[model samples]
Target: MLEVVAVCDAILHSPWLLPVLVVLIAIDGPFPVLPSETLLMSAASVAFGTHNALAVTGLFVAALIGSVAGDFLVFGLGRSSHRVLARATECEGGLSSWVRRHLLLRPGTVLVGARFVPGGRLVSTAAAGRFGLDVPRFLVGSVASSAAWSVYMLLIGLLLGPITGGSPLLSLLAGAVMAVLTAGLFALVQRVRAYRARRALAAAQHPTEPPLVLVAPR
Candidate 1:
């Protein structure tokens, strides 16, 4: 806790912190392990302590822009090399096999929910690119979602100020909770995917099985 507070104080006082924050957000859009929310919350807490409202707002906007830019870039890459990516991954077979075996078959909720899950954001973004979703629509959704996420984290930090006696303990606790929740959600989603895949395989293997006949005759 002392270490976290020290780091936060340094970032808030440093001149290069804003640029570092932007870089971290950008990298997080392509890499799943960056923990964008923790960074945002930490930055927000620092800004709150220093009364730097403008800097805090800028950080949020920058994060949203970075997310949209990265997502769009991947989308374009997916579009341009659709054939190559498909061939490389063996589109019809390997891709489908992965989707089934790893429980990525149904991505509807997962795609939207990924923005909230640590380590899942990039995977979901890459999956969206691979699936050929409309770029403009995706950008709109990403911007909105990223902005909302940024604000939520900032609020978390502000709220923690009162609860933890102005300590950084709340920020660390929030990060831990987010991590645990994300892991649980990911596990549940995979389970659902597995169940769905098994059902599909069973149906395919026994297509000719007649429906059970309910006989009321004597």
Candidate 2:
């Protein structure tokens, strides 16, 4: 653990960290396991103390660009799977059924909000591509979300500096813990929602018959 912390501290203090941020953000676009937010926060804390505002701004821009590229790549992959997804949508089962039951009819809402929600981000993007969303529209929504996410992380990092005593490592760790908790909470909510949805479907399909009316004999 000490070695890891030392390594993290070294990296946080390194000049090369900015490029590393770009690659991490790219990976994070499709995979939630990567803590891109934490990285940005850490970099921001360092920049705050060093008075390197340009680094902070550059990091945000790099992250945003990487995210946009990553989302587009995943969206393209999803488009390639269009035939399979279409078949699944027709079957009224699995993720397709859940999406149809829960999500709005308009694809734009899904495209815009997916990037804000955990798990939903990449999945919804892929779904949009699979559903034949216009490439231009999809790119527009993706750019918007990526920009918002980048700015949010940068600000969070800057704000966290004072809170963590300008310790970039601690701030990064806290952000990572928060991300993990957020993901866990999302998973729990999804499980409960899925259970409720399944129960409702079952009740609708096989509702208990009303108690038989007993004829009173005079």
What are the Cα lDDT values of the candidates?
A: 0.59, 0.69
Cα-lDDT of candidate 1? 0.59
Q: Return the top candidate by lDDT.
A: 2
Give the per-residue lDDT of model 1 (tens digit) for 16-44.
76676677777666555664556566566
Off by over 4 Å in 1: 1-9, 49-52, 80-111, 164-218
* lDDT tens digits, residue span 1-218, model 2: 56756766777878778777778777775565775666676777667656678887888788888888777776776778856434534455444554455433655565555555575566766676666778777777788878877777777666666767767667667666666776688778768878998999999999899999999999
Best by TM-score: 2
TM-score of each: 0.60, 0.74
- Candidate 2: C-alpha lDDT: 0.69
Q: Flag clash pairs in model 1.
A: none
The reply for model 2, stretches above 4 Å from the true place, is 1-4, 45-56, 82-105, 155-159, 208-218
